[model samples]
Structure formats: C-alpha cells, structure tokens
Target: MEKTNSASRFVDLVQTKKSFEDIKYWTWSEMLIALKQCQESPSLTNSSIMLKKCIDLLSQKISLADGASSSASSVNSSRFRSSCDSKSTESLKTNFASTTWWFEDLLFFSTECLEMFVQSMVSHEFDQVLLSKFLIHFQKSKFFNATSDVKMKVIESVIDMLDTLDENVLSLKALFDILRVTLGLNINKGSKNRLEAMIGSKLGHATLDNLLVPSPYGANYLYDVNLVLRLFKAFLSGGINQASPSQLAKAANLMDSYMVEVAPDPCLKSSKFLALAKVIPDSARKSYDEMYYAIDLYFEMHVGMSEEEKEKICCALNHKKLSYEVRIHLSKNPKFPLKSTPSSPESQQPETENLLQNINYSKSLISWPHNLTEGINTDEKEDKSSEQIVLYHGKFDLPADNERFKVHLEGMQWRVLELEKLCRKMQTQMRKILKSRVASSYCQVKSLPKLCS
Candidate 1:
C-alpha cells in the first residue's frame, strides 16, 4: 500500500515537472529512493511505475530542449507579444543552451535507472514489459547523442546485463540486439576503448567466435554479417594488444571463423592473420595453431585458381629462412601440422623429395650466399642407410652432458628446423596473400567504368 502511494506520487511529480529545475528538484533523489523501496518490497509495480515516469520525464525534457533549439527561426512575431516577450524567448533559448550539462546527466541517470530496473526484473524474474520498453528505447531512441561518458555507462550497463547469470537467454538475445544497434553508431574513441576492455573481460572466445557467424534474429531481423565483422575488427584493433590470453585465444578463433565466413578477400584475411599474430602471446600455442590452420585453410580453398593466378601469388613468396626467435620456439612442442597442399603435383614432388631425402635441410637453403659454396665438402661420403649427417648451426648445450641426451637434443633440433621451414613457408604465404589482394583490387578497379572527374 505504501509502495502504491509512492508510485502514484512519483508519477504525479513527473507529470507536473515543466522545467529543468522542476525535474532536478522533483524526481532525482525521490525516484532513486522509491526505486530502492520497490526493489526491497515484494511488489515491483511501484518501481516499474517510477522507472517509466523517469523515462517519460527525460523524454519530456529532451523534447523541450529540442523545441527550444530548433524553433528559434521557426517562431513567428505573434508568439512574442512585445520586446519584453522577445527578451523572454531569447532567455528561454539561453537557458536551454546553459542547461546542456543537464542533458548528459539526465542520460546517465536514465541508464542507471534502467540498469537497476533490469537487475530488479532479472532478480524477480518478472516484468518483461519494463525490459521490453528499455530495450526498445535503447535500440531506437535519440538519447545516444549524449556525452561520451554517458554512452560508456550505457554500454557498460548492457555488458553487465549480458554478464549476469540471472539473466535468461531471451534477455541476453535482447541485449545482443541492443548491442548490435549500439555498435552501429560512430562511438567516440574513449567509449570504444572502454567497450573493448569490457568485451575482453566479459565476452570470451566462444561468444566472440559465434559473433563471426551470422545470427538469425527471426524473419524480420536477420543479423548483418558485415556488422559482426566490423565489431570483430573493432574488438581486435581497439587496444586489443592489452587483451588477456583468454581474450587473445578467442580473438584468434574469431579470426579463423572470419576466414571461412567472409567471401575470399585476401587482404582482409591477411590483415586478420597479421593482427592475430601481433597480439597473440608467443606462449599461446593453441592460438598459433589456429592462425596456421586459418592460413592453411585459405590455400586449400584457393587450390583451384589458374596457373597464372598461382604464379601471381607464389611470385611474392619470400625464400628467406626463419629468424632465430622462431627457431627456438620451433624446438619446443609448439609445432602443428601444416594443412597446406602444393598448387600442383609437379611443384609438390620436388619440394617433398628435397625436404625428406636431404636430412641436411639447411644446406639446401636457397638464400645461402653463393660465396659460401666452398664451405660445403662435396667430396665427403656418408652411409645413406646408417649415420645421417645432421647439420648443427652452432654448439648445442643441454643440462645433461650425456651422448644420449645430445642425440635427443639433435633430433629435437632437427624437428625444430623442419618447423622453421613451415614457418618460412607461412611467411611466404602471407606475402602471397597481400599481393593477391592488391592484384584483385587492381583488377576490380580496371573493370569499373571510367568516369569524368
């Protein structure tokens, strides 16, 4: 009964507010207090009423502000009775301009109120009407033009609701719809950074990866795949270097999925791979594997390209050996099988035979200086069936100073070198990917109709 009176009084206060001062003096403190009471009480009927009143009050203030600013030229001379009344009109505009700070504050308070209302609804597990209204307003309202800090709070609230365990999947889906709409805005830089940090903390690998694929939002509202890609790019490039390992792994998985979902755009794919490589910690073996897998999958998908197209890609391939940093990690268990196949059978056989037959793979290095030819003892003979001469770049050191340990180390080093070859091939593949994109872009431009500037 007390909650009912409080709710009725809140509605009366809001409906009676005619100016900024009235809103400030009438609702702010009383509304929060009434909301708290309603939260504590078993019935949220009053809380919902109070929240709706606040929303309506905010909308009324915004409408007044908009009218004051926009009607300056549209007002007729009859509207101002005399010079004194004209002064009053000018004063009204001045007051609206001066009260711009109230706009941001109102938005911030509304978001807070909405967030509280959402929490109450989720906790009570009732009041779908309030949730539905909030989502609709958040999705389509002009309140988004408020200050960056307010925008950040709004996004923060949505993400908080998404992270809440009490929130059902339907509520989550509604929040996602809100996010998809929110993300479409040209958010300020500060808000984007804050948002990325929130996403890293809240949205994990699976969530991000699922975003890469298009989600069907019923027959009327199909989720845009391009928008999801833009969001993914924002998450990655928006200070993603500071993301945690788990976030990095999720980003890697998202990139992998992006490769498959988007049409064959080499530049986009390569950029994602390079970005993933830059952020992924060297210790993140699973992410590295995903990166390689994505790259290998690209090559596999494009195996049907013409011979000329293949040459165009392969011509950019770098024959440079792997760096020492990569070689060291190669010796660790960071190796994953390369899923790439050669462009042709003819190109495949020689490379396969060369890699397999010649245990001294380093000696077969094409990038080696021609002046170092004399260093190779061509006259040396080896038992092909028995003692394979393994080339060591420098002295090997192990904690155990035993011959058996030395043999094991040598074998591991050999495998590492083999992995190094694969890494180099991947680097070459990266160059090819970049070149292919450039070539494709050029062809597209050339195909376009010429126009006068």
Candidate 2:
C-alpha cells in the first residue's frame, strides 16, 4: 500500500512537470483553445490571465530563437572562412544548415500563433492594449521582415483577419499604425511601389471603398479624407500604369470622390490639376466630370450673384481654361458626339458670330419701351443710324411681312430710338469734354503762332 502510494505521487509529479513543459512551448492552436476554455469557466479568470502570460512568454521565446539563429548563422559563416578546406568544415556546414532549418520551423510556428492570436483577439473583443501588443509583436516578427513573397503572404493574412474583426472592437488607430509601419517599411525598401498595383488588383473596388469611406464618427468621416487622398496619390504616383484596369478605375473613382469631399485647394491650381488630370483614365472620365461639376456648382453657389452669375463663374472656374477645353475635346470624340454639330460649312464658320447677332436683335426687341421714355435729339439720330447699319450686315435679315416679325421690327425701331437718346446723352457729355480740350489746344496753338510771328 505504501509503495503504491509513492508510485501514484511520482506519476502526479511527472504529470505536473509535463503540463508546465507543454505550457512553455504551447502551439498557437493550443493557446487559443486554452484561452477559449478559460473564457467559458466561471472560476477561471486567474487561469485565463496566467494563460495569457504564458502565451506572451512563448512569443518571447520565439523571438529569442530568431536572434539565436541569426547569431548561429553568423558564427557558422565565420567558421567557413576560417576552415574552408577542412573535412570537418563541410560537416559543420551541413549541421549548421539543418539547425537553421529547425530555427526557421520554429519561426514559422510562431508566425502561425501570431496570426491566430490576432484573429482571436479581433474576434473576441480583446483589450485595445492587448491588440496593440499583438500588432507590435507581428511587426517585429521574422515573418514581417521576410522576402517579398513571404511578407505579402503575411499581409494577406492580416487583411483576412481584418475582414473578420467587429467594427466596434477593431482599433482603427492600431490598424492604421500597423499599416503605416508596414507601408513605411515597404517604402523604405521600395517595395510599396511594386505592391500598390497588386493591392489594388487583389482588394478590388468594394474593399478599397469600404476602407476609404467608412461609417462617420460624429462629424468625422471613416478615414481622414486628406490622408486617403494622399495615399491614393502616392499609389498612383508610384506607378499606377502597371495596375490592372479595374484597379485604375477604382483608384480614379476614389480620387474623384475624395476631391469632392475634401476639395483639395492645391488641385484647383494650374500646375497640379493639370499634372493629375493626365493620369485619369478614360474609364473614370465620368467620375472626374461629376467631381468637376460638383466643384463648379460649389463655387457658383457660394460665390455667384445669381444663376447667370453662376454661369459666368463656371466659365472662369478652371484656371487653365481646361473645363471648356475638355468639354470641346469630349464633344469631339466619336463615342460622344456634340449635341449641336453644324453640318453646313456656313453654319460652322461662325456660330459665335450668329449667336452674337441673335443676342443683339433680342436686346433691340426688348429695349423699345425705354427709348420712348427719353427723347432723342437730331445729332443722336445720325449715330443711331450708323449703329443700325452695323447691326444689319450679312446675317440678321428681318422678315418684311410676318406679323411677329413686324412686331419685332417695331420693338427694334423703338430700341433704336432709345439708343439715339442714350447716344444723345453720351454726345452731350463728349461735346462738353471736347469743347474744353479744343479751347485749351486753341489757346496753346495761338500762343505758338504768335511766338513764331
């Protein structure tokens, strides 16, 4: 009975040590299971805390393994330099290579743990601080600093995890910070330029749209419009031509929306807007036009006196006169024909001239009543006839017999009388100025002639 009791105690001791050993090297999957179990248990809050600590410790061990592997690799490489010709050196190299593989496996395992933990934390509503710690660990991991292929895989994993996270629990600041860091590293290494086109292609429009235009917080929109604008600008500036057509389209759409919401003041300038306009694809022209119209409307609404004033404002909005020029260009395209294309050579030669003639005739028709209010003098009639002669050239021929034409002619006649009265008013002011100038000149000339005589 005493021996059996001792044997049972020994078995229990062995089991406890094994449990401790298992915790020390806990796989990510095991840690997750333990965490879930602790979460479910009523009296396991302390156990959960302890498990978290264990997971953290395991993460540290993984980091140490990386450092140890790097050091070992360096040492092995040095040994090759010292003893290249020795038989033992070959054996040492083989052994070192195998050891390195073991370290790599450990790192791979740790990466798996990190990925799972990130997903778990995101899903389970872990503390922001804990999530941040996980992100920091992730950023510091060997997987993050791996080859482009490897890093992209890790990035994809993170993005997938992002999809699963609850919006309320997801830490925007933390995510942004991680993205910023990753982007910085990519930028530093010149990998971001290569990755951008791929990111656009893989993520597609909907994902990007969601990221850029998230739900509004208070008055603040999802992402900072300015920041998102800058990010897209950076991506395009890097080498957007390499991106897929859909990616280019998505980028242009986002940029168009961003320009409207943020209304980048710099983009209104000649040099900047011109530079960016070149990159906008044909697929996104409609979006660009909409943004342009919105900006035009905004300026008109905010600055103009009336709708007519707004029309004038629209004409002047683009500093480079690009708006009208672009309209003409678009109108000329075979795909989008102009609404009022002049078929005849005569009609085409002077649309503006014809428009001006119509405008003058309309003005004459409207001004008839005003002429009657003010009387015309004799000198003013000669000036009025000269103006009427100018108005009647080549185009603008009036019909002689139609009742409507007769009414229009009568109105124009009244306007001519009004013009004569205005001419008389202007003639009186001009005559007075001329008299003063002539008197002064005459006095000077007379004095000059007297002096000469």
Clashing pairs in 1: none
User: How many steric clashes between backbone atoms does each model show?
Assistant: 0, 1
Residue pairs clashing, model 2: 371-418
In model 1, the worst 10-residue window by lDDT is: 333-342
> lDDT per residue, candidate 1, 209-282, as tens digits?
34643444442323344445445555555465555777766655665565445424433433333443344334
| Candidate 1 segments exceeding 4 Å error | 1-177, 183-192, 207-209, 213-254, 263-281, 286-290, 296-453
Tens-digit lDDT string for candidate 2 (98-128): 3232222223333445565554443333443
- Per-model C-alpha lDDT, please? 0.44, 0.44
Name the candidate that leads on TM-score.
Answer: 1
Superposition-based RMSD of candidate 2 using all C-alpha atoms, in angstroms: 19.8
Per-residue lDDT value at 442 in model 1: 95
Per-residue lDDT, model 2, residue 96, is: 54
